[model samples]
Target: MTYYLGIDGGGTKTYALLTDDCGNVLGKGVGGNGNHQIDHALAAQSIRKAAEGALNEAGLRIHEISHTFFGLAGADREADYRILHPLVQDIGFTRNYSIDCDTMIGLRAGTNRPYGVALICGTGTNAAGRNPAGQHVQVGGFNYMYGDFGGGGSLNIEVFRSVIRSWDGREQTTLLTPLLLNFLGYDSVRDMFDDFQDHGKHVPVHAAKLLFEAAAEDDAVALEILNRQGVELGKSASAVIHKLGMEEDRFDVVLAGSLLTRGDRGWIRNMVEQTVAAVAPNAAIVTLATEPVVGALWSAMDADGHAVSQDVYDKMRVFRNFEHIKHQQDKRL
Candidate 1:
C-alpha cells in the first residue's frame, strides 16, 4: 500500500504524520523547532528526523511513500523555499511533494467543500479564506512587526505595558503586575527594566501565559486587554469574511492555532462568537484541537483530488479522540 506523509512545521515544534493511500494515519513523530528564522539547517534536520521516525513507527520505508505534504511557517516566499526545498529533497522520497504555508492547510482541513475561513493565532497571527470558486484572500500576515495582533507576543506586550504603568503609579494596581514580575523572574519592577535593557529582546512570548492567569483572578486590566484582543481578532476575521463575499454564505470559520486550541481560548472564542454571530450569523464556529499535521494530511488528500471518504474521516476522528484522551490523562498525571 502506498503511504503519504504530512508535516506541520511550526515555531516551537515540528509534527509528522504517516498515513496510507486511503488516509488512515498509521503513526506519528515530532521534532525540534521548524521556524524558518531559527537556523534552517538545524530545522530541516529536525524535520527529516521526525519524518524518518514516523516512517519507522509505521513499519514502513520511505520508498513506499507516494506523496508528501509539508505545511510550514515561512514557506510562503521564494527565499524560504530556497532555504527549505533542498533540505526536504535531501530526504530522497521523491515521488511527489507539495509545500505551502500553515494557513493554507488549515483552511482545507475542516471540510470536503471548497469555501471556508481560517484564523491562526499562535506565536503569531494570520487569516485566510477560500471561496468555492477557488479564489482566495488573506489579511494581515505581513510579519510580526506590522501585524500579528491577538497573539502570544501581543498579549505579552500588553502585560508589560500594564506592569510598567503600575510601576509608575499611573494605573490602578492589578493582579497582572505582580504576576508579570514573577514571570520575568525579577524581584521588583526596576529589575524588569534592567533585564529588558540587558537582554535586548523586546517582547516576551512566554509572558502571555500571565494574561490567562490574570484573567482567572479577575483583573480589570487583564480583562480589558483580552477584550481588546478579541475585538482585534474579530476585525481580522471580518476582513477575511468580507473578502470572500461570504457574508451570506454558510461556511465554517475554523479557529486554527495555539491560542485558539488551548483552554485559554475562552476570551478569543467569546470575541469570535459575538463578532461572527452579529455579522456572519450563518457561519459556523469550530476549533481545530487536532494538531495541524492532521489538517496538513487532509490537505494533502484534497490537493491530490482524493475524495475524503467517510472511512478516512472516521479514522482521523478516532485518532483525534485518542490524542485528546492521552492529553487529558497526561494533564491529570
Candidate 2:
C-alpha cells in the first residue's frame, strides 16, 4: 500500500492531500499562510503542519510516502527555489519529491494534455504555459512594482486608492468611500489613513468582496474596477498564449483563484472569457472546480510512472465533491 503526498502552498493557506497510487484520496489537511516571500519560517511551518496533519489522518508515517509534489507560491526564481527547496526537502521526509510553482499544478488541473496555459488570479496573479515541444513560457509573477496586476491584492489597493481619491475630491464621488469606512469601522477616510500610516493598518483582502457587493448594486466605481481587472487578467492570459505559440492550437486555459471563482461578481469572469476568446479563439477556458492538490497528486502519479486514466480523474473529482459537501455539513454542527 503505497501513498503519495501532494501539497498546494498559497499566499493565504496551505493544503495537503494524501492518496494511494490508484488516486483514492485518504486524507486532507489545511494550514496557514505558505507564501515564502512573506516569511520563510511561517511558510515552512505551514507546509509541515499541513503535511503532518494529512499523514496522521491517513494513519501513515511520512517516510512511508513514495513520492511528493509541492506546488508552492513564490517559487518563480532561483532565489525562491533556493529558499523553498530545502524547506520542502527537510519536511517532505521523502527522497523523491519535486517543487514547482503553483501555476504548474494549475495547468495540470485543467487538462491532462501536455500543453496548455494557466492563469492564477488570487491574492496575486501569474501566468504560465507550455507548448507541445515542451517549451514553457511564463509571465507576470512578479509583484506590483514589476508590472503585475489583477488579483485580490491589486483590487484592494485600487479600491483603497479610489476611496482616498474620492475623499480628496480628486475623483468622482464613489460608494467605495462610504462602504470602505463602514467595512473598516472608521468614521472617515482620514481616520483610516491616519491609522494606516501610524499603525501599519491596511485594507484586508476580504475587502475585495466589498467591491463585488458594490458592483452587484451597480456602483459605477466598483463596476469599473472589476472590468479593469477582468481586462488585465485576459491580457495576461493572452500574453502567455502568444509567448507559448499556442494561439493557433486548441488548448486549455485554466482560470484558478478566488477572484475569478467568486460567484460571477459583476460578470468579471464573463469579461475575462470574452477578452481571451477574442485573442485565442480556439482556447478552452476552464475554471478549476476541484482543489489543485488533486493536480499535484496527478503529477506525482505521472512522475512515478503510473497510468492516470480518465476514470482516475473522474474519481478524484467525485471525491473532492464529497469532501466539500462533508465539510459544509460539518460547519453546521
Candidate 3:
C-alpha cells in the first residue's frame, strides 16, 4: 500500500499525519508555528521538524512516502510559494506534492461530494466555495485591517472599543470591563491603559470568548456584538452560495474556526443559523467534521479529477475525532 502524508500548518501550531492507502493513521507529529507571516527560517524549521518527527514515528524514511499535501496559511501569493518551495523540496520525500491555503483543505474535507463552501472564523476569516460546475467564489479574507469580520481579531477589536466607550461614558458598562481587566492582568481599567501602552500588543483576539460568555449571561452589549458578527458572516456565506447557485437542496456550510465551532456559547451559531435560514432556508450548517490533513491528502490525489473513492473517504474519516479540541483560554489550555 502507498504511504501518504498530510500537513496542516497554522500560525501557532503545525500538525502532521501519516497514513496508508487504507487511511489508517500510522503516525502523528506536532511542530511549532508554520504561518507564512513568521520568518521563513522559523516556518521551515517547524515544517522540517514536524515532517521528520512524523516519519520517524511511522518507521519510514523521507523518500519512502509517495505523496505529500500541505495546506498552509502563507500560500496565498506567488511569493509565498517561493519562500516555502525550497524547504519542501529539500525534504526529498514525495515528488508528488501540492500546496494550498488552509480554506481549500477545509472546503474539500467536510464533503463527500468533493464540492461545497467552506468559511473560517478563527484568528482570521475567509470564505471559499466550489460548485459542481467547477466554478469558484471567495469573499473577505483580505486581512485584518481590511475585513475579517467574525474572526478573532475582529472580536478583540470590539472588546477593546467597548471598554473604551464604557470608560468614556458613551456606552453602558457591562460585565465585559471586569472580564477584560482580569484577562489582561490589570488591577483596574486605568491600569489597563498603561499596560496597553507598554506592550502595544494586539489584544488576544481569542479572548472574544469573554464576549461569548457575557452573551450567555444575557449582557445586552455582548449579544449585540455576536449578533452583528453573525449577520456579517451570513452575508459572506450568502455571496458564496448564490455564486454557486446552490439554492435547490441544502448546500453544506463547512464552519471552521474558533468562534463558529465552539459548543459553549451557541450564541454566534444561533445568530448565524437564524440569519442564514431567513435568507436561504435550504442551507445546512455543520462543523468541518474531518481534520484538514485528510483534505490535504485528497487534494494531492484528486487535483486532476472531480471524484474520490469511498475507500479513501472512509479512511480519512477515521482520523476525524472533530470534538477533541475545544476553545479555551490560552493560559488555561
Ranking by TM-score: 2, 1, 3
- Compared with the true structure, what per-residue lDDT tens digits does model 2 show for residues 209-277? 778877888888888888877787788888888787777898888888777765445367777788889
C-alpha TM-score for every candidate = 0.87, 0.92, 0.85
Highest-TM-score candidate:
2
Q: Which ten residues in a row have the lowest lDDT in candidate 1?
A: 317-326
Local distance difference test, candidate 3: 0.73
**Candidate 3 lDDT over residue span 1-333, tens digit each:** 677778877665676788776667787676666776655777777788777877988999767777788888666667777877776887664467788777778777777665777877766677778787888777777575666665776688788779878987999978889888888888887778777888786787567788877887888889888888777777788787787887665677777765776633566666667766776687788777667667876775565343557887876765754233222223355
Model 2 error, position 29 (Å): 1.1
What's the distance in Å from true for residue 145, model 2? 1.1
Name the weakest run of 10 consecutive residues (lDDT summed) in model 3: 322-331
Candidate 2, residue 144: the lDDT equals 80
Task: Please identify which of the two predictions, 1 or 3, would achieve the higher TM-score against the true structure.
Answer: 1
Name the lDDT of candidate 1: 0.76
